[model samples]
Target: MNTTTAATEANVTVATIRDWARRGIIAATKAAGRWVIDTASLAHRIAIGAMKRPAKPARKATFSVETMLAIGGSRWQKNGMDRVYINNWANFLPLEIDQYKTGNISWAAWEGQEIANRQALLLLGSIDKVWFDSADGELHGRFGSGESRIATRQEVWETVVAGIRTAIAAL
Candidate 1:
């Protein structure tokens, strides 16, 4: 039968029938320059319930500000940083973190700001002068010229809190 007639009989769109034909899900042949679908094959396949569209994949989850804050806040407390300092940092950091979480800012931009925050805390004597060297991918401390080690974001938060603890202890 003609593509349109076959599609109407199958209760599907002509486009869907054409796609099935192209994908070899259903068989078709050209007769006198017109596409002809065999009714026998189509009916047999329909009876057996073989025709179906492929399922789409689910979306992956992105990072959230709440999760980041929880992890960072826990680390801050564990590192013995002063409550006042931790509270102040927590209050200001959320705006930027939210921007990152919502994808308004890139990962590189967020990392840059984080690095700047680390530097500022060091200058204010709230934390030791620890810096991340992007060139060599190493973290350096103020006490020594050489790199101490590489650190993850959580580890960086720990270091920042430790610095705050030291500054408070000195007071």
Candidate 2:
């Protein structure tokens, strides 16, 4: 099987597969913008002690936000709530969504956006509607009446932690 496909099937990231290659735990070669791995070697590594298994991060309502950011951005984020919210949302999107070259695409290239938005709704939560009432104060009143089927904030944090553990184990 193809190395990249095998790694993904095994729930291991490409970087981790590469590290295993460099460490002589897996045989791989870059070909056609993809890495091919020897299935036999991978199994051997898993059987022996050369390849360490990944451990899931401890669950917590409030894990280090910086650690979550580091899992992808390589830098800890200490910005305010808005920035953090955006980052969290971005992390949940597909890599293609994050990689969109908005500058080159025309306005008509948004069917993809609709698909992504719908998928995000399922993965995160649906935004039924938001209301802003300016009757009380300058801030007014806000409400989030979305479907409650998606992941909670704590669940999202735990998912991030799990992802980080998977990534670090590969590295």
Candidate 3:
């Protein structure tokens, strides 16, 4: 059988089948510049693979704020970035109610924010109506309508932790 057919039968990739043939781990021959795998040899290889012990699970890589940030100030953040740069990243992690009066999107106080569905959700706790109170400098929200309770800074940080930063680090 061809490498493709062998790979399907063996429950592996075609590349793996080719590699095995190249390494002489399976009885195969090249005809018309393609690998022809022997059925008996493929069966033998499958049996051997089944007999082998499963490999240990990979160690979970550290991907939290502490592990990925430039600062460890009880937050995931950095300072000294220019206004344009900060605003750009702040837009990356947008808020449902953005009322930055100064147009200065805070970026240094966003710790543990990626877990929230939206920045407002972080403070509002999964609500329908949400808004930012610029005068009080807080987020506001309620169950379905009418009057909003302020989402205080004490409830969550003012700044936003850009998810792109952590996402890149993961790669």
Q: Which parts of model 1 are misplaced by more than 4 Å?
A: 50-171
Please provide, for model 3 over 61-159, each residue's C-alpha lDDT reduced to its tens digit, 9 standing for 90 to 100: 333333423222122123632111121222222232222477433321122122222444344332333333333433333443222133443232222
Candidate 2 lDDT tens digits, 60-164 = 332233433444433222442212121333232221122236532111101122233344444444322111112221111122233323444444444444544
lDDT of each: 0.41, 0.40, 0.44
Where does candidate 1 have its weakest 10-residue lDDT segment?
90-99
For model 3, the local distance difference test gives 0.44
lDDT of 2 at 148: 26
- Descending-TM-score candidate ranking: 2, 3, 1
Cα displacement (angstroms), candidate 2, residue 151, comes to 22
- Cα misplacement distance, residue 113 of candidate 1 (Å): 67
**TM-score of model 1 relative to the true fold?**
0.28
Sorted on lDDT, highest at the top, how do the candidates line up?
Answer: 3, 1, 2
Stretches > 4 Å off in candidate 3: 54-171
Best by TM-score: 2
- TM-score of candidate 2 against the unseen true structure: 0.37
Query: For all the candidates, what are their Cα RMSDs to the real structure?
Result: 24.1, 10.8, 19.1
The alpha-carbon lDDT assigned to residue 108 of candidate 1 equals 15
Clashing pairs in 2: none
Best by lDDT: 3
- TM-scores, one per candidate: 0.28, 0.37, 0.33
Worst 10 residues of 3 by lDDT: 81-90
Q: How many backbone clashes are present in model 3?
A: 1
